[model samples]
Target: MADVQSLLDKGSNNGGCQFIGIWGMGGLGKTTFAKALFNKLRFTYEGSCFLTNVREKSKKHGLDALRKELVWSLLGDKESHIGNAIYPYTMSRLGRKKVFVVLDDVNDHEQIENLVGRHEFGSGSKILITTRDRQVFAGIKVVDIYVLEALNPNESFDLLSIKAFKNDYDDMKIRKLANELTQYADGNPLALKVLGSFLNGKNQEAWKSQLDKLQKLPCREVNDILRLSFEGLDEEEKNIVLHVACFFNYYYDAEDVKKLLDACGYSTEIGLTRLEDKALLDIDGGKICMHSLIKQMGKQIVREESLKYPTWCNIFWIFKKSSEILKKNMGSIEGMIMNLSEVEETRVIIKAFRSMPNLKFLRVYGNLNVQLRNKLNASGMMFLSRNLMLLDWVGCPLKTLPTTFKVENLVEINMRYSKLTKLWDGEQNLVNLSKINLSGSEDLIELPNFSKAIHLAEVDLICCRKLQNVHPSILSLHSLHCLLLIDCKALTSLTSNTHLKSLGKLSLAGCSGLSEFSVTSEKQLFLWVCDATINGELCSSSGHLSKINLVRLQRCEGVTSLHKLVDMRTLGSLDADYCNKLASNLCSKFDEMRALHFLRLTNCSELYEVPDNISLLASLRQLDLSGSNIETLPLSIKHLSSLRSLTLNGCKRLLSLPQLPPSISLLHVNDCLSLETLHLPLMTEDREGDEFSPEKFSLINCMKLDGQSIKAVEASVLLAINNNKAIYFWAKWNIREKELQSGSCIGLHSLS
Candidate 1:
């Protein structure tokens, strides 16, 4: 505690902006220290936020959700709408407010940028970052970087005694055993606690036996001490722990693990909880987050099962061992995950897979380079195991499945970006199949009859450029929930069946050859028809199908307008970027879209002026008009009370902009070479509502715009640029006379 307080004192004491980094190896209690400091300093700030398990949570739910959570935590606003670009909203809301924030377990620099960009927070704000890798702190100005050390012998003994015997150390025998255990722990607190608790209730003879084994094989490393905890787990719990370490720890979600284990007759609910209680795994934001040391210990246990017989282990993860086993034909493995994306290409015989008779789950991942280079000759081994259930091979370079392979018990097949023209030569009974994801299979030309796949729920064929025909039996599947045919350039037609009552989303974007479509179902929530040259009128013949929440029709060369959306009251997002042929006059009809929250018209080089009534979209949050030919914006834009982001990038011919609402926090006006006049609202106490300055302002490449126009807008912005020495603002700017023009003066859009 004294060490923590002493380090805190070394930070910037005047409440100026500062960043403190705490870095150390796994299990050194970096998170624990950060949490303690957060609790101690939280009350001193106007607002505070603590983001825990940032690395793990970013994988499961994505960084956008985390940004929303951060907004709610710091600003205490439950209804804050966070867009895809989250930094602007965070800066707009929290920039001027003194706050304390702690980002825990950050692994990537991109994560740091998206969460907390070049810190422009309030003067007294403090940001703390904690990570296992010291290199992650590079390029950031940190006031102090404290590396946590292992506990002392006495402290380790006390922690062990508390967890093991509830602090009751009066008995000499117990005290002696505890002291010996602490020494084996070697000042690592996690090892001491786990080992001490494993031998808590055992008799002295049992302790003696355990100690004898420990003496024979001394616990010299932290992972070795963690191995003892594994020894105490039952067979079922051990399997669960091993599975997590091998597979789930990397990317698999907890629900997927639960389903897989439950199918294997293991009580996954109880086993997972037991593992968590034993400190083998932790559940963060509903995902498995195992400590790095625990995962290492689990992998070590599997490798030790038979160092000479690695294939005898229940799971395989290491690329070297799996590759060696396959190359040397030394042994057969149970299940494996092979990712050769970042490695050099290597050719292997298909018989390598045939040797693994017990293989049930196999996942092969590759990059474009591997797909083009690696070869897997299957002429010698044409038969696949009948026990295979899940086969996911991304970037596979095969024309078809093995002739002898059967698909009776296959539950899922994901072969994205494969070079296959057909999945199979003949019809096969896919009785248990639930999903088929052949997305990005550019050369795929056909799909087998899915009539026998009664349980099939989804079929994705996105970007299958050569796929001209889809199986007619698809319309017969009543249980199908999603059918994604996005960018199937060669597909000319599709028939929508009314039996697909559960169909939720249908994407046909970029299918330039598609001219016919039939829609008979009404359950679709998302419809993306961008870049398609559809033959028929959209929703003109079909009765009003009104349940859609999103419609993307960008670059649909044949469609001139969204005249068919007269009844789509539920539409909230519309992205028509680069839709060259979209009629510009239809912008007047957008007033009917009162529920829209996001509207993007980027790169629509043909669209002219925006409709004056566009401000009728009262609930709109984001409005983008980048790369459009629009000449002027409606002055009524100030009436959009809910607008947060307004992008007018590349509006080369735009003459002027009207008074923008203070509700907007992000503005982009780059490359507007012809934009001569500007109007910025001045900040004053009389300004209507809570005013927020633009967190981000870009004016790059506007060659004809005068720099003095920006100076006259906000004088403080010049001071801010000079004070912070912002590197991003160093390009050429033509400075004009320093005089405030009459009505074109810049106002509250200052760079803070």
Candidate 2:
């Protein structure tokens, strides 16, 4: 509501035709917001019209009729007959009138363009659009694209309470059930209302039973509305959505899932983007997130396919059903995942694969207890489907794969914490394999030859303690992007002969015995050599280091300086924390790192002062100098327009700080025993529009702050309050009564 009003106000000032798009998932109340906005602003315009369900209306009554109706609504005339040139006719009639128009539930760009021509409305006119497809607004001159988010927990509870109990029921048990239902709905307004209405007069036991049933089946009304988005997807997108709903919903990284899907011959990059744009799936914090109801809707789609012929389902995840299908040798099954954590004992027959020749994806995962591990056995397993594409088995019990198992079609093999001493006797056809993860395989001493796996993109061998050497074939993979070998204690050296053009990330952290490391991948973006014994010269000798964006050298005793990286223009993050052997003057050429955004030099005991030119990193956003030996920062730090966070905790040697930038939003000076002086920009009324106040200010254990410093802190708090921003201020000493005279100490509290 606030967003729409703000846009409308801005449009009023600009005096021009304005268009706004309200977009989100199906059940997020996009239409409700649009309706409220329309009603509130309609009285201010000369004419108003709301076209509801434009997508459905266009299909039912045709676009011509909707266009004619729009014209008649704004012109206040009922036209009997209108010609095919409705675009020009409607524009000519309505262009002189200031109006408020809304097109709700639009799904395609054609509907928008055909109904309302480009910028045809008069000056001071406002047009609002609500849609599930964000692509509908492409190429249109929209002033703002407001994405409506789901309700928060409190709002969801209040809405559900009003609908179910009419704000009268006060039973604690029923309220608890209502809270659980709201959580299960995942803040979706439509699901909350549906569940609330269904359980209006039901008893406690009925609510519990309904909740239990909802876990496996979504409400019919909610499912039908949400499934409209799913029904519009293409076949490949439908398959991808089902894959996430059944297997990878918030369980794995989106990149890993994308790799697997791409290997299955789907256009995953574009498909995932399109799904996200449609709001059926969300990629949050690098994980695929889907609403609870949407997930259940997708799973129900698959369940409906197996209603008559149980063996014809495309995928299975329930342990009982998957086990039954496997035992019955259901050849039509394409994928199955079995989690063994709930089972006490289970036995797999090795010959089951011979009957199910169509299996493409198979995964077995669980934290098997000691008794279950001993009882569960696959000792005689000898055959696997030749058409297998993905084989992910956590805690695999096999010592080696069966010799007859073909690897020609395998796309990914992930067997973490396995008991395998080796993968196979020799290399087989692996042309289609793209990823291999054998991390935590302590007993594994070597990797299989991957010379023919030309498409392999990632290989992870973290914590493979006994793995002494990497196969030479791995270095020749031209398509490899990530190679992680963290904590491989016995691994001594890694040398690459040819240039790996596609390699991007290489990590050798915790490899204590690593002495020699070299790579020729000029396109590498990240390199981690933390806690390793590799010589510093090896890093400096890499001619392609200039292209790397991040480099971690923590606890690297042999390193004395980063003078060698003076020319890395692309380096954005440099972490040299706890590098005790680092020289006081680590790197004097900070001006060369034009792209540096994060600089962490914490616990670098030998660092006495930061380079004066450090202020030249115009893109730097975070600077951490905690537990260092610096006494004072350069005054030029105030010139850093992009720095937002500064950490100076445990800097016992520091005596004072300089004026920080107005962009700084966080400042921490905890335990700074020698901190006697502090400098801050004075807050005044003239700087209202330009001020950027700190959201968090910490002064714990800084007892030496003088009276001037305390006053500055108080003024900063008042400024933040005036800006209507939440501020977290922590101080160990009691604030003076004079400082609280203006009520600036409302949110300030003592940490002591």
Candidate 3:
């Protein structure tokens, strides 16, 4: 506590704006110490606010909502600003007021920029940030930093005694037990507290028995405490933790795990939260994390089962014993993860899988160096269990799956880098299948019929270089949400008439051989950003696409027009940043999408002009026309009442811009070397439309601005900078006759 206070004083005692950072590993009491410091010093500042769960809340909601909550908490008001205006509003409201703020569990630097902006508050203000990853503060300016440490042996024992044996502290036997338990805890307070509570009411005999059981288990005290957390969990939660501990600890995403566990009839979200509460698991940076000790405990439990039945263990990690285990007909195995490269049983019996009747998950991966005849074969077991849910096999040598293999209950199949030309001989009734990945299967030529896969949500066939055709039945999936066929060079077309109403994302990038995108889904699909050869036409004219929020196309050749959007009304954003062949007048169709808020047409080298009536999109808030061939803004652009940000970077041909909109707050015009004129409207301090002025302005490398235009807009730039709006000016200009006479060229060119 004294160290923490001293660190805070090093930043706050000088009455200068300061930022302090606290970083350490998990279970090190970072949050506990920060909260204590917050309570101690919060009253000294004029206003204070502590933002909790910054990482989790930012994911569930966006940063904009968090910004609003911060503003409301600081100003004690009913309503504040919204959207891009929040930054300026926060800077204005907190500039002269001394403040104390603590942002807890922050994981991104952008969150800090959005919430705090800068340390420009009153002289006495101080901001504290706490996080588990020290790299979260890499680019931020912090005056002081502290790394919290774990407790010592005596400190650990005392903390445990208070929680476990509060009323009977003098008993000699219990004291000895406490000493022994602290050795296991190793200065971790969470483990000490949890273990102490578990032993609170037990008798000396019970304690002795528990200690004896621990001795039999090879794990030391920390693993035993983690095992206690596992013991408190229900059966479903236990399965979830064990699966994460064994296979999906840091590789698979949380959402993917949820999908797999959900297929296994477990309430995954609730179970994960319960495990986190018990300190057995943590979700950090959107990935699952578990301590090494906790994970070892889970593996130990499975090995104990191996001790009981060495041949039919529920988990198999020994590859040399495969032949003996299979020949003995051990059938209790539920999970198997094997690497074929290290196996010494080369000519094992072909009936191994048949003995394991309860297998649910199987993953086999490794480089098999043996010849075809020397490999351990499985021809005798023609059929797999119907209860199997996940099958991930790499470098499979068979030309097709076994003829009698049952796949009715399978939920996921990943055969990446396999040698199979086809999954099966024909379509099977795969009703429960949700995900299928066959990437890098160069010999795969076609897909099986998916009409019966009603639950299918995602399909990935990326880089299947030899894939030539897709089964038309895949187009009819009603529950499909994502479909990826990137780099399937030989694939030519999709079903022209089908309804994929639930599909939201479709990717066909690098499908150079494909010349058509003829699917016709309903109007319910919302977002589509894909690279497909459309033969110089946009979406199918006959199909009705709903109001999509975003559509991005890159490097798609022979795409000349978007006339298909003439009837759509709810298009929100359109991006064709590098479509070099696109040379049409897109503004002619812009009027049809009145709800469009963002439009990006950067680097479209052939785009020589924009329509004069482009300002018809009253809802446009951001317009990016960088790296294009346009020479000047359309006169009608002044009518964009809601436009707030206009980025025209690298517009080499642009010579001038019309009067910017009154709602504009950001203008980026860097690298416009041909620009010579810029027009600025007078700004006032009123709430009406005429009082609006940009808070952020950049003019780096705009070399050709005339001296007269620079003189004309210099006052507005100075006014905005004086108001603390952060205006920057960089212009290449020759000395005017009057300026040369006064010798003021150096002072007039640069503004900081």
Ranking by TM-score: 2, 3, 1
Best by TM-score: 2
Q: What digit string (tens of lDDT, one per residue) describes model 1 on residues 1-752?
A: 56655665564533356777786555667788899989998999898899998877998999888877887888887666645644566567676888888999876667776776544667667778887545556656555677676788889888988887888766788688778777666566767766777877777777678777764343445664456557666888888887677555344557667866776567999888767655566666778877645665675666565355655566654343444565444344545555555334343334446666666666777553645344553342255556666777888777878656877867778888888889877778888787788999999998888889998878999989999978878756777778899879899887654435666777887788877765544565577786666633465334545456777876676665554632446678878766655546457667677888998888888888877788889889999999988888888888888888888888989877777776666677788888766664321112332244445556665556555456534442443333332212212235533432223223422222
Q: What TM-score does candidate 1 get on C-alpha atoms?
A: 0.57
Q: Tell me model 3's lDDT, rounded to 2 decimals.
A: 0.69
Give residue 577's lDDT in candidate 1 (0 to 100).
69
The lDDT for every candidate, in the order shown, is 0.68, 0.78, 0.69
Tell me the tens digit of each residue's lDDT in model 3 across 254-322: 777787778667799988876765556677766777765566677677656554665656565435555
Error of 1 at 382 (Å): 8.0
Candidate 1: how large is its RMSD? Answer: 19.6
User: For residues 116-152, what per-residue lDDT tens digits would candidate 2 score against the true structure?
Assistant: 7543677888878999888888867555789899999
Largest lDDT belongs to which candidate? 2
Per-candidate total of colliding backbone pairs? 3, 0, 0
